[model samples]
Target: MQNYIFEIQLKVRDYECDIQGIVNNAVYQNYLEHARHEYLHSKNISFKQLTADGIVLMVSRIEMDFKRSLTSGDTFAVKLRIERQGAKLIFFEDIFNVSDGALYLKAKVDVIAKINDKLSRGEIFDTLNL
Candidate 1:
C-alpha cells in the first residue's frame, strides 16, 4: 500500500478549465507543484533560504498518468510521499476527488539538488531525515 506523507486540499477554478469544461492538462502540474511547496513549508524548508544558500532543488523529470477529469468547482486532494533514489529524490504524488474518492492523476517527480551550481546529492533530505 502507498503511504502518503502529506496532503493538501484544493478546488478547481473556473479559469483552469478548457472549452470541454475539464481542467487543462498543464494545470495539473501546477497543483502538484503547489502541494510540494506547501509540504516543504510544513517541514520548515524555505525555497528562498535554499536559494540564498546556493542550494537549488529542481525537477529533473516528471511522469504523470491522468485517470479522470476534474471540472470547475470540483474539490480534490493532493497527496505526496518522498523517497531517496540513489542521487535523486522522487516525489510520488496523487490527486483524488474529495467528494467521491475517485483518483484523477498520479505523478512521479524526480528531483535533484545542485550545490553551488554543481549537481550533488541533496543534503536537505539528511537535514529533514526524510
Candidate 2:
C-alpha cells in the first residue's frame, strides 16, 4: 500500500490465460520475476556480470495470494519494495489492475546470493546500495 521503489506495467496475454479465462496461477511468477529483473537492471545490476563475477542471486522462496482474477487484455502494474534481512533480500511485490486500482495479487519473494557457488553473508547486496 506504500509507495513502491520500482514498478512495471504489463498486460495479460491471451496465452497466459487458463481454460477458465483468467490468467493461470503459475503465470504470475513470470510477471513477478520480470519486474524484479527490470528493477535490478535499472539499478545497474546485470545478471550476466554477476555470473561472470561468480556471484549468483537466487530465489529461495515465493508466496503469492491471489485477490482477483486477471483476464486476458487486463492491464496491470507490478510494484516492488525490498528490505535486507540478514543474508536475504525480502521483496514485497504487489499486482494491481491499472484500470480500476483493484488489487490482483500480493506476493513476497525471498532472494539470496551465493558467491562462487557458496552462500555468502550478502556483502554484495550492501555494495548494491539497494
Candidate 3:
C-alpha cells in the first residue's frame, strides 16, 4: 500500500496571530484542516460526495508539536501524508513550516471512515483511489 501526500503554500494572516505577533495555537489546527481538504481534493474526493455515499470521515485523535513561531505576513508550506491503518482507519501526518523550510508545527491525526455510523468494512483507501 502506498501513502499519499499533498503540499500547500500558505501565508499567515494578521487575524490569525495574537497580541504577541505570533500565530495562535488554535490556528495550527486550521492549517492542518486545509491540508487535509487539499489531499482529499487531489484524490478527486469531496466531503460532500463522501457524505452522499454514506461515508463520514471523523478525526479520532490529534498530536501536535510546535517548534517555531509564525508571524503575520509570513509564508509557509503545509505537507500532508496519509497511510492506511486497517480497513477502518487511516493515520495522517501534517507539517507546517516557513517558506524557507523552517519547521513551525507538526501534527499527527487519526481518522476513520464510517457508513451508517459504522466503519466501512471494505478496502477503505481504495474507495477513494484516483
Give the best candidate by TM-score: 2
Model 1: lowest-lDDT 10 consecutive positions: 121-130
Give the Cα-based TM-score of candidate 2 against the true structure: 0.97
Each model's lDDT comes to 0.93, 0.95, 0.76
Better of 1 and 3 by lDDT: 1
Instruction: Tell me how far the alpha carbon of residue 130 in candidate 3 is from the true structure, in angstroms, after superposition.
Output: 7.0
TM-score of each: 0.96, 0.97, 0.86
**Candidate number with the higher lDDT (2 or 3):** 2
Candidate 1 backbone collisions, by pair: none
Tens-digit per-residue lDDT, 25-111, candidate 1:
999999999999999999888888989998888999999999999999999999999999877899999999999999999999999
For lDDT, the strongest prediction is 2
Candidate 2 CA-lDDT value: 0.95
Local accuracy of candidate 3 as per-residue lDDT tens digits, 20-120: 99999999888888888877887778988888888888887888988899999998888766666665344455455666667677778877778877876
Residue pairs with backbone overlap in model 2: none
Clashing pairs in 3: none
